[model samples]
Target: MKRNPRDIIVRPIITEKTVAMQQDDNKVTFEVAKGTNKIEIRQAIEEIFNVKVSKINVVTVLPKKKRVGRYEGKTKGYRKAIVKLAEGSTIDLL
Candidate 1:
């Protein structure tokens, strides 16, 4: 099934590591829909952000068990994509 660009990319991941990568490696990180693939992520980013994507890497975060007081549960799992942009291109996340 084809997904909308906006629907495929959940949000930009803003973190110390991601920020560092953006500055040094011309790359950006995003939290994306779990069912989305690398190709979808690449297209979504290129279309929505208007940046040329050079490469895409996807990673899945497994849920971890946590205990709060008397309750024991697992945190929600999610997928993240690391998109490397063309050398001369950039995305103004701000």
Candidate 2:
């Protein structure tokens, strides 16, 4: 089934680590749909950014437990993809 690129790529994740990766490793990070795979992610990113994808690394992040006084909660879990763009290709996300 062909899915919308917007649906496949939930949103871009901006963080210090991700920013460092983007600058030094030519990689960008995004929160992708849980059910999506590497091929779908690659296609979505390529289509949305119009850039060549060199490699993809997916990481399943588990929810983190948190507490405030007597209240306890867990942060939502999501999947993140570290996409490495091909040489000479770049996405200006900032």
Candidate 3:
């Protein structure tokens, strides 16, 4: 099935560690839909950023527990993808 560009990519991760990665120049990562596969992720990034994707690595994170005054809950789990572009390719996400 053809995937919508917007559906392929959920959002770019903006955190302390992800920010550091941009500075170090190793790998760029993003929060993606749970059902998105490696091929979909590569195509999405290439189409949106106009860059070649070398490889992709995915990680699944489990939900974490949360507590309120007298209640407890768990945060939603999410999937993250670490996309590696070709050596000379660069994405100016900053």
The top-ranked prediction according to TM-score is: 2
User: What order do you get sorting by TM-score, best first?
Assistant: 2, 1, 3
Question: What residue runs in model 2 are displaced by over 4 Å at the alpha carbon?
Answer: none
RMSD of each: 1.1, 0.7, 1.3
TM-score, every prediction: 0.93, 0.97, 0.90
Residue 15 in candidate 2 has what lDDT?
94
lDDT of 1 by residue, 1-94 (tens): 7789999999999989999999999989999998888888888898998889999999998999999999999999999999999989998785
Question: Candidate 2 on 27-54: residue-level lDDT in tens?
Answer: 9999999999999999999999999999
Q: Measured by C-alpha RMSD in angstroms, how accurate is candidate 3?
A: 1.3
Worst 10 residues of 3 by lDDT: 18-27
Checking candidate 3 for backbone clashes, the offending pairs are none
How many clashing pairs does model 1 include?
Answer: 0
